[model samples]
Target: SDIVTSVLDVSQPCEVNIAIYDISGRCAMERELEIDCRGEVEIELDTGKLSCGVYEVKVLSNAGGDKSRFVVVR
Candidate 1:
């Protein structure tokens, strides 16, 4: 399994949303976090529960409208 993490820069305190999607493009897990300006965060993803295939991890900063994507393999 693979673990994914990312750092985001937010201008203000807001909610951050992270979602993990399986090979079928279905969201498997969702997490929300509160971040402050210029704050950094790390997220550990558990890929063991997923099948041996490709997965997509998306991070979104709700307040700043920022988004990022990552690929994971199990």
Candidate 2:
């Protein structure tokens, strides 16, 4: 199982894009959300279809973000 945690200090309403990619840089999953103002949110990832391996996570927003790597094991 995997989860995504996103924190934002938005000054106005906007959209955020989140993505997960395999080690080979293939997109595995992606989500776009609409949020307002400033807040923090957690998203549950359905990783049941994925095989055990390493992956990269990313967040795209006006407030800037970082990418992280993670591993899933069977």
Candidate 3:
């Protein structure tokens, strides 16, 4: 699966940490990406092994961080 989101107000290039957590707060998937502060970032997630449920996504970088929730139907 793919997750696309935007990082706003970035002042410089940096390394961003993206992590997906299950409802129990356990880390299910994680990846590190280097971006040039271009405003939007698109990421690919391997969800084949993940169970159908609600999950949280955390995006962290030197500029800032954000959290959002998602659901997997299959």
Candidate 4:
């Protein structure tokens, strides 16, 4: 049971990409998210479907072209 959260700073009308990868270095889930320009946006991840191990979470913004990473444990 792990939760992964992240925030991105973007201008008005932007799209963001979120991805989750398992310990085997393969992508497990991915989503294309849209964010409104103003404040921080948060996303939650459910690790129930994943095994008990370390996983990688990646967040990317289309407007600012930024990439960030997070670690998830179950």
Clashes of 1: 0
Q: Which ten residues in a row have the lowest lDDT in candidate 2?
A: 1-10
Candidate 1 residue-wise lDDT, 1-74, digit = tens? 46666666666777888887776889888888776556565657666566665666677765644445555553
TM-score of 4: 0.69
lDDT score for residue 31 of model 2: 83
Expressed as tens digits, the lDDT of each residue in 1-74 for candidate 4 is 36666666555667777787776879988888777666666667666677666666777765545445555453
**Which portions of model 2 miss their true places by more than 4 Å?**
2-12
The candidate, 1 or 3, that scores higher on TM-score is 3
lDDT of 3 at 8: 42
Rank candidates, TM-score, best first. Answer: 3, 2, 4, 1
Off by over 4 Å in 4: 64-74
Question: What is candidate 2's CA lDDT for residue 60?
Answer: 82
6-60, model 2: which lDDT tens digit per residue? 4545556678887989999999988888876555555566777777899888978
* Model 3, C-alpha of 57: deviation from truth (Å): 0.1
Q: Compose the digit string of candidate 3's lDDT tens values, residues 17-40.
A: 889899999999888887775655
Per-residue lDDT for 29 in model 4? 82
Using all chains and alpha carbons, the TM-scores for the candidates as numbered come to 0.66, 0.75, 0.78, 0.69
Give residue 44's error in model 3 in angstroms.
2.6
lDDT of 1: 0.67
Candidate 3 off by > 4 Å: 1-11
Preferred candidate (TM-score higher): 2 or 3:
3
Q: How many residue pairs clash in each candidate?
A: 0, 0, 0, 0
